[model samples]
Target chain A: MTFLRSALVPILAVVLAIASGAIIIELSGLNALEAYKALYDGALADRKGIGRTLEKATPLVMGGLAVAFAFKAGLFNIGGQGQLVIGALFAGAVGYGVTGLPWIIHMPLALFVGGIGGALWGMLAGVLKATRGAHEVITTIMLNFVALNITDWLTSKVWREPGIIVRTPAIESSAEIPRWSQLPTGFALAVAAAFACWYLLERTTFGFEIRSVGLNPEAARYAGISVSRIVILTMFISGMLAALGGAIETQGIVGRYEPGFNAGLGFNGITIALLARTHPLGVIPAALLIGAMEAGGSTMQFKADVDPEITEIIEALMLLFVATPILVRWVLRRRDTSEISVGAHWGDA
Target chain B: MNTLSRYRWWFVTAAFLVAFTLFTAEFQQAQTTAVLAATLRQSTPLVLGALCGILCERSGVINIGIEGQMLGSAFAGFVVASSTGDLLLGVTAGIACGMLMGAFLAFLSVSLRGDQIIAGTVLNIAAIGLTSFFFQTGRSLPSGKTSRIKLGPLADLPILGRVFFSNRPLTYLTLLLVPVIWYALFRTTWGLRTRAVGEHPSAAETVGISVVRVRYMNLILGGGIAGLGGAYLSLEAVGSFERMMTNGKGFVALAVMIFGRWNPIGAWGAALLFGYANAVQTQFQFRGWLADDPQFIGMMPFIVTIVVVAGFVGRARPPASIGQPYSRE
Candidate 1:
């Protein structure tokens, strides 16, 4: 009963979002049913389709987990994009920079290095907030640009492949994450990370401290919790999760670190986290739903003659609906209003 | 002397840099004037966005949705102008779109009591999706861009003429807005109420000022300002619109707003500094100065913003009640 009550809003939000998306499709002179059908067929019709959906879901789960973890500490790590970029670049660097290692060693090494790189980037924002009271929103946004420039420079200059293309050399096969019938090992790792995050947040004393700080920092501090340490550690872990997503993209999917491939993936994490109500376990299903949509986007466009970006519109609408449950409650005639609080106050940590 | 003493090193460094650059053979007076002019042009949108931020934030509403407003307006302005062949109509359309977005933001953040940041994120995402979905590839503008205006005698002044006196309509309006908005914000009754509401909405409500009304008005007004900035980009600067072209200017404008300490004149100065950095970046790219490594040059403005936000330069305090929704009992 409790699970049903908790799940009702998100399910309704998705339905409402898709219904409105249908209207948008009709306005665009396309058949909504056909577009949705195409989307369905492309995402879950066969083994290949199932494989593709899981493949897309892999990074999304990591991204969603990253945002959700930060939300637990009342920190908005908008720099997930920057952290992801740094992670991918570093993973790519390790993948190509080093040679002759065993497959087990090289792949894990690259992934670990990527996560550390992302953690460092995230920790930069955490340090700024912890020490200087700089707002994470602004600093993280700024860091995204910095990460973009730095990565672009590295790819175009220092780590450029032979000629013409502004991309790093392809990673050695030894460093590549193994895939089983279109399911990359990253998806398993994502599920494991989700469970780990759940355990950390629900079962551990440290998780309690993090949640305490998130709920009321003053009280948490009074209770002898080091709010600064929690903030920093949460961001560090969040960055690692986002970076792991980027690393998996490099090792399992993209083969090389090219700018723009991972564009909006980090931002999509925002939508996913909101849709999941920032629950660690819920992020998996939320990610899969978005992943399926993305996997099928090209098919929807091909068959329905509608642009693929309509999915993004639906995603945004879902975010809006999830963020403002009051709107949903009014529509559904529900009385209980849940306060969805995430992020820290502006100009302070 | 006391104030000047605080900034003595700034002046000294400025003078030393000018002297150092003057000796470089590549530096010509004409080229330098051109760069200065470009700097003002580059800062037009940024300054306008900052002013918009100031208005909304001063009313206790955090308008992180400035980027969405700008992008949506830019797209609308370009589409309307290109389709209808009327530049004025396009600007109006742009402003209308921005105002609508502002009202939506007001509805979500004020009436609905949603998370201001998440609402902003939604606006940004929706704007990007909607604009890109509707944007056609081969549209051409029938009317040319808003041309530069010559300020009669001032147009002939040495360097100041090209940099300030001669510019597009929006650039002049932006410059005019600094003092106009400063006076309005500092000397007017409405300004005091807005500040009161931002600092303490309960107190403002106690004083019989409608906190809700003030926030709604300010958000709509700020949205219009951001819309004007969008129009400046498509109709004045490039006379064209590209998907996601407002880029990160809206976010950078927030940084400028903070660095300016939420003051209009200070914001303008901060905008000008960023504009100068952008102007230098463009020069470097054009002249092949850092020919082999342009990315570092591109990163300068963002890096500077981070440093500023980290309080490395100076600390800034936001309004007391910012990012909070007020409830009436």
Candidate 2:
């Protein structure tokens, strides 16, 4: 019953969102049901659709983890973009350069390298916040612009495909994540990472320490937790997870580092993290749901003649509903059990 | 004097390094200076956003939706400007749009007691999608075409010209705005209260000051200023409205605000530095210095941000209660 009630909120929200979307479509002079049907069909109706859904979910899982874990430590990590870019770039560099290695060695090497690169990138902001009292939100955001220019330069200059567009050379076959027909190796990795997050966030002392630090850094400090160290480390790990997403996307899905393709994905991770209630384990279902929405975005347009942007509207509505749970609570007549320290009050921290 | 008071030396050294790279690179000095001027002009919108950030944060409101607000203005400004062919009307439309967004965000986060970060992020997403949708939908119509307003050679005068007059009206307004805002922040009575409210609203409120009202007013002003930034981009900088046109400048403005330590002078200084990096990257790339591998060259600003922020340890301080949404309870 508790589980059902917890699940009911989102389910009910989804119904309302869908209904609202249908009404908009009706007003716009289209078959509302047909648009929705196309959406579902595009997301999960068949092999190809499911394949696309997983490909979309692969990076989302990593991105959500980046945001979620940082949320655990009460950090708003806008630098996921920076971390993701460096990680993807480095992973691609290794994947293409390290030839003759077996798949086992090469794949893990690329992933590890990507994760570390992301971690290093994140650490820049973390170190500043810890030492200088600069907000992670501001520092990471600044770093993101820097990362964009850097990655753009790298792709255009060194990583460019011969006489072609600005992107890295494709990874060697050995570095490629194995695909199971329509199922990408990246999807399997995402699933494993999700379970791993579940174990780490809900079942470990480190996770507890991170959460405690997030909840009340002063009290956590009194309890002997190294708050500043934890903040920096938490951000580093959070960034690394996000970077892993980019690396996997490159090696397994996209096969190259392209500019602007991962538009707002990292930033969107914040919305996903909030909707997931900041639980690392909860991010799986949240990411999967959002990933499906993203994957089906194109079909939603083609069937209804509505711009694909309506999907983003629906997503934003979901974020809106989740962010302001009071509205949901009022409709449900539930207590204001909505607050979970979204800001986490860093200056005080 | 404080230990490590040689911060200015670090800036000088960094400046020398970048200048050395720019001079020795294939780019000509005139072109480099021209690019710097262009870059300054490019940074006008970002500077305006940073200014808005400074205002709101001073009054103890974290205006995260500056990005969204900028987008709204950029879109509205471009559409109106393109239609009317009048920059002022476009700017007014942009400001109105930004003000609406700001008012909505403030209402939800500040008045309604909603989560500020969540509200801001949601607003950002909605803005991007909403603006892009309209941009795409309007593409079929004539109103959605990109618009521009270049004062031509007015963007190039003498000493004052390169410093101020060399750009469009937006650039001039942004530069002229710095001292006025600086005065307002430190000299004006309202600015004093604004900072006082952010630092300690309880103390401010204890003495006949209305914390909520001050925050609300500052937010609207800040939002309108950010709207002007958006207008600068669409009408002056790029002279067009692209999908997600503001890119990450709003977020960068947040960083610039922080890097500047919430002061108007600091904001201009940091923005100019960032703008210089941007101008240098383009100039170097065009001149073909490290042309084969100029990608990293473009990334120098981000690297510089990291270095700058890291260098700010024990020094960089934002407005007190900057992110904490004020509740009268």
Candidate 3:
């Protein structure tokens, strides 16, 4: 009964968001039923469609885990975009820079380099927050612009593909992550990462310390847990996970680092995290749902003459409903028993 | 000595501006008047956005939805102006749209007691999606630019005329709004009550002040101001709306608010500083120095924002209960 009650809000939020999207479609003189049917068919009907959906879900799951991990430590790391981009650039460089290496060594090296790059980028905000008392919200927002510009410059001038195109050279074959007939290895990696995050956050002593600091920093400090260290380390892990997502995209999907190719993946993480209620395991289904929407968007546009941005509207509405769970409780006529404060530590942190 | 130390950043900025103007031949070679004019023009939306931030934050609501409000207003202004060919009506429509967005934000953050940041983020994402979706539905209106207005006689005054008088009516209104907001925030009784509510809602309620009402009023007012800023973008500046066209000026306004230490006049100064940085980058691009590397030039404002927030600015004290939702219970 408790599990059903807890799950009711998200399920209702998704249903409401889709209903709103249907209203929009109706207002636009399109048949909502037909559009939805087309959307579902495009995302799940064929093997190719399923592959595309899984491919999109892979990065979103990782990005969701990144955000959920940080939330457990009472941190809002909005620099997922920056970390992802930096990781992609570093991983791309390693993928292309070295040659004549075995697949095992080269792939791992590239992934490690990308993860480290993201960790360093994430740690920069962590250190600033821990030492200088700078707000991560502002710092992370600023870092997104910094990352965009730096990566653009690097691609255009430093690693230009010998043409007017602003992208790096194609990565070596040895560094590529192998894809099975229909499923990509990256999807498996994302599922593994989610489980690993769950274990780290729920089973380990360090995870307990991180949770304690999140709950009450003063109490954690009195208990001899270094709050600052945990904050920095949590951010590092969060950033590394996001970077690994980027690395996988470069190694498994794109096979090259192109500007504008990975634009909204990081921002989508915010939506996924909120939808999942910051749960490590919940990230998978939430990511898969959003991924399906994105995968079906183009087909919806092509067949039903609906704009792909309808999907974005649905996602935004879902975020709004989930963020204010009170609205759900009110709609369901349920008493608010346990209040999980999502952003009480926002300014305080 | 204490006073000197307090305004040290101002002194340093002034000294740097003076040094750059006097030493850099490029400043003289490139039309200095043109640069200054551009700086004022660029700062108008920022000034208006900062005022919105000031109003909301002063009333204990943390409004990061300024960007979304601006974007929504910009779209409304452009659509109304295009449909009616009346700039004034378009501007009014824009302000109305902004108020509606503010009301929505208030409903989420204040009534629902949701996370303010999340509410703001949803506003931004929704604005982007709604505007883009509507825009894609063959609703592209004819492009028409708002006419520039020049103040009589004052327009003839030397360099000051070019910098201040020779611009659209909206720009002048934005300039006039700075002092008005400052007076409202510091001198008026309503402002005092608003600040009291922001500082301590329970205490304010004890003194017969309605904290929730004050927040709602200020948030709507701030949204109107931010909407005017957005209208300025479509009607006065770009003369048309594009996808996500307010860019990140709303976020920049947040930085300006922090830089100004939440003061209206200070926000104006910070906006001007950012405007100056933008003008300098444009001048560099115009002179062909940064033509090949526009990305770095595009990065100037964000880098300067980071530097100012990290190094130059001191600890910014926000309103005590800025992000907290108040309830009578």
Q: What fnat does each of the candidate structures reach?
A: 0.67, 0.64, 0.50
Q: List the residue pairs that clash in candidate 1.
A: none
TM-score of each: 0.95, 0.89, 0.95
Query: What's the lDDT for candidate 3?
Result: 0.84
Q: For residues B199-317, could you state the per-residue lDDT of candidate 2 as single tens digits?
A: 98888988879988888888888888999999888877766788888877888787688777788888887787777777777766666777776657866776776677666534565
Q: Give the alpha carbon lDDT tens digit for every residue of A39-153 in model 1.
A: 9989989888888898899889989999989888888878889899999999999999999999989999999999999998998888888878777778888888899999998
Q: What is model 3's native contact fraction?
A: 0.50
Residues B237-314, candidate 3: write the lDDT tens digits: 988788889878898898898788889999998998889888878677766877888889888887888778777664
- Please write out the lDDT profile of model 3 over residues A1-349, one tens digit for every residue: 8667666788888998999999999998999998998899889889888888999998899889888888888788888888889888888988998899999899999999998999888888777777666666677778878888888899898887898777999999999988899777899999999999999988999999888877777888999999889989988999899999999989989998998766877669888987888888889999999999999989988898888889989999999888774876675587563533445555554
Q: After the best TM-score superposition of candidate 1, give how far the Cα of residue A305 lies from its true spot, in angstroms.
A: 0.4
Q: Determine which window of 10 residues in candidate 1 chain B has minimal summed lDDT.
A: B16-25
Which ten residues in a row are the worst by lDDT in model 2 chain B? B139-148
lDDT of 3 at B118: 81
Per-residue accuracy of model 2 over A120-174 as CA lDDT, tens digit each: 8898778887877777876787778778778787777777778766788888988
| Candidate 2 ranges with C-alpha deviation above 4 Å | A20-31, A93-106, A145-174, A255-261, A328-339, B1-36, B137-157, B313-315
Error of 3 at A112 (Å): 1.3
Per-prediction RMSD in angstroms?
A: 2.1, 3.9, 2.1
lDDT of 1 by residue, B1-329 (tens): 99899767556745754564344316788867866787788888999899999999998888888988999999999999999999989999999999999999999988987778888888899999999999998897898888889999999999888888988888898899989999999999999999999999999999899998999999998999999999999899988999999988998899889888899987887787778777767667666778777788988888877776675434478888888877797
